[model samples]
Each structure stands twice: as structure tokens, then as C-alpha cells.
Target: MERIEGSGASQLVQLIRAIGYNSEITFELATVTSAPPQLKIKVDHMNVELEKDDLIVAQSLTKHMRKVNLNVKKKASISSTSIDSLYTLTLPQGSGEWSLLSFGLNSADFKVEEAELEFTDELKKDDRVIVVGMNEGQTYIILDRVVMY
Candidate 1:
């Protein structure tokens, strides 16, 4: 069993985190007669096999992949109001309706205006929706919007 260390291990951890898996990792080595040796990593809900060639390049790439910050400001002309309390809602694409899934409230159908939708093609099942309220009994779905900077 060859020990994987240094940047190789760091890149492996980063890849695991990128896939949204935050749990203990376990590594095991087993000999195979027909195939070349490879690293087998398993975590809850995920399984990965990494060969020696991929691991070498991944180590260098991971070192340079660091987070950077940017300043974001909303356009002045777009009038907006503060949301008192926001809740995340999820609706299946093309369903044409939404049902509130929290606070013991009855599920009701809500409509989303086409102009409010942003990145409609990238939506997935149960994707997050921002819920904003104008006042009690008045709520709106803050769909993805296209704004020109």
C-alpha cells in the first residue's frame, strides 16, 4: 500500500469538499491482478478512483486554486425593498407553481413571472428560491434576474 501524501492529499480533500461531501474519509488498499495500482477513496455517498498520473497534476493545480473576493453593488435605478424575513423555497422547473414547505402552512400554488426568472436553463429539481414579502399575506418569488452593469 503506497501512502499518498503532501499536495496530493490536499487536492483529494478539496475535490471531496467540492462535491458537497463533508464527512470522515477512509482509505483502503487492495491488490488487483489485472489493472495497475490506483488510489481508492470512499466517503458517504461518494466513491472515487484516482490513478497516479492524475494525482500528480491535481496536486499542482490545487495549490494555485485559491479563493478571491470581488465587490458587488446593486444598480441604483433598480428600486428594491428590504425583506423582513426570508425563506428558501424549491420548485421543480416547468411546474408553473410553488408550494410552501415550512411552518405548518398549507401548500399553495404561486406563480412566477417570466421576466423575473434568471438562468432558467440551469434550474434543477428542488433548486433554491428566494422568498421575499412585501407585507403580511403578500409574498413574491425572487427569481433570477438579468441586470446590466
Candidate 2:
């Protein structure tokens, strides 16, 4: 599988976190029957086409992300501390914040930042970084790979 490194992995993780953690969220691999074949995500009751540029990026990211173990021994509970439109992931080491913007699935975007330097999945705790994706009856959680450090 292709491996995402450096800023690319960080950016992809941010995007996944921006999607938020929802068990009901699902997606499917679809081929657009257009002039040129394209990939699309059938999610959230919508058929959203992936932008050409984004598709290339997603393909690379997904390749690497799929190889990582996304399963957590314990699930982290999601909570909101403020009325703002953002979700926070509180871990034993520290906390990170992310905001989500949804326009169907194609226009979905997320803003995230690198958390405390000590944050990592190797730390035995439930508050590890996770990005969930569902399809049919299957669910997946992509874990953050420590590629930089």
C-alpha cells in the first residue's frame, strides 16, 4: 500500500477528524458513468463526486490509511464543552480540536490542528486519534501513523 508521509498525512488526518465520529456514517466506491470515469462517494444519502484533484489525493491517503490498524481496544467518548460548532478529542496526553463543514459529502471539509507533542496511539489510553468510516455493515477507524516522529 502507498504510504502518506510528512504534511500530507497530517492534512489527511485533519480531514478525517473533521468528518466527526458517527456510527451511522457510511460510504461506497462508485464509478461515475460520465465522459471520463471518475470516483465518487455514495454517502449521507447523496451521490457526491470526488473532485479530480481530491480523488488523487484521497487515493494516495486511503492506500496508506487502510494499512494501519484503526481498531482501538477502548472507544473514546465524544463530548462538547462549548456551544461552538467544533468537536474536541480529549486524550490522556492532551486535547485537539476540529471543525466540520458539510455540503452533502462532496463539499465536506474539516479544519484541524496538531495537538500536544506527546499525543500518540502508542500511549495506552482510550483517547487516541481515530477516524471512523462505515460501509454496508462494516465500520473502520483510521489511526494516526507516527510518520514524522
Candidate 3:
């Protein structure tokens, strides 16, 4: 059997319809900038009180007050199996108007699919770098092959 000299092994090449072979083309994309969602926490009642940690702040529409306290409690604690294990803020009224402001991740299971991997980070410890996939019973993270500086 005769072999071609100076030729590499039989390789599979991905080709585009109009574009020819993409062997020498490499993508060096610039960094990506993402802005987090703007979340507003407003108490629907005048007598509503809000507390993040040990400090407490009151919200009163009658008093024309509309600013939330910026102090956050800092502590180390293990996460609970139930979502309620994290701190639950008390709304003035409602069965449980408290939404999960942040979640802590004790452990995570990850998988790469189509060169994408998704994950979640515990806000308190992970500098909010944890990733999360938002789907009912499908909370998984999907990270793209792209990298950010």
C-alpha cells in the first residue's frame, strides 16, 4: 500500500456551504460583559418592616420612605435541604411573600453537553459565580465554551 508523503492522518473536517475548510480559522472573541437583573424589593404596606441580618429597617408609604437598607448580615451556615433553610424575609402580609434573595450551594453535580456546562454558586461564599439552570426540576447550569476575562 502506498501512502501520501508529508500528509497528516485522515482527518474529518467541518465545512460550511459557502466557506471552504475552516482549518486555519480560529476565533479569539473579546471579553463578554453581562449585567445582572435589577431586582426591586418593595414592601406593599406602610407598616412593613425589613431586616437583612441583625439590623432592621421600616418602610412606610405614609412617611414617604422608599429606600431599603443596604446592610447585610454575614455568617457561615450550612444549607438546608428545603429552600426555606435560607433566611426568609417577612413581608407585612401574605402567606409567604418572601422570595429567595440568594441561595447557598453545598454541593453540585455537573455535566458538559454540546461543549456547554452549567452550574450554580452559593451567593454567600462563591462571590455569586455559581451558575444555575432555571427549569422546574431541572435546575442545572450551562456554560458556553466561550471564556470571559
Off by over 4 Å in 1: 1-122, 145-149
> Per-residue alpha-carbon lDDT of model 3 for 98-127, expressed as tens digits?
756566644444333344223332112111
| Model 2 per-residue lDDT at 142 | 32
Best by lDDT: 2
Q: How many Å off is the CA of 95 in candidate 1?
A: 66
Query: Scored by Cα lDDT, where does model 2 land?
Result: 0.35
Q: Which should have the higher lDDT, number 2 or number 3?
A: 2
Clashing pairs in 1: 118-144
Instruction: List, residue by residue over 35-77, the lDDT tens digit for candidate 2.
Output: 2133232222235533333332222223222222223233333
Candidate of highest TM-score: 2
Displacement of the residue 75 alpha carbon in candidate 2, Å: 45
Question: Tens digits of per-residue lDDT for model 1 on 58-94?
Answer: 2221213333443334322222355455565566786
Model 3 regions more than 4 Å off: 1-93, 116-149
Better of 1 and 2 by lDDT: 2
Q: Rate the local accuracy (lDDT) of all candidates.
A: 0.31, 0.35, 0.27
For residue 133, model 3's alpha carbon misses the true position, in angstroms, by 50
Superposed by TM-score, candidate 1 places the C-alpha of residue 4 at a distance from the truth, in angstroms, of: 38
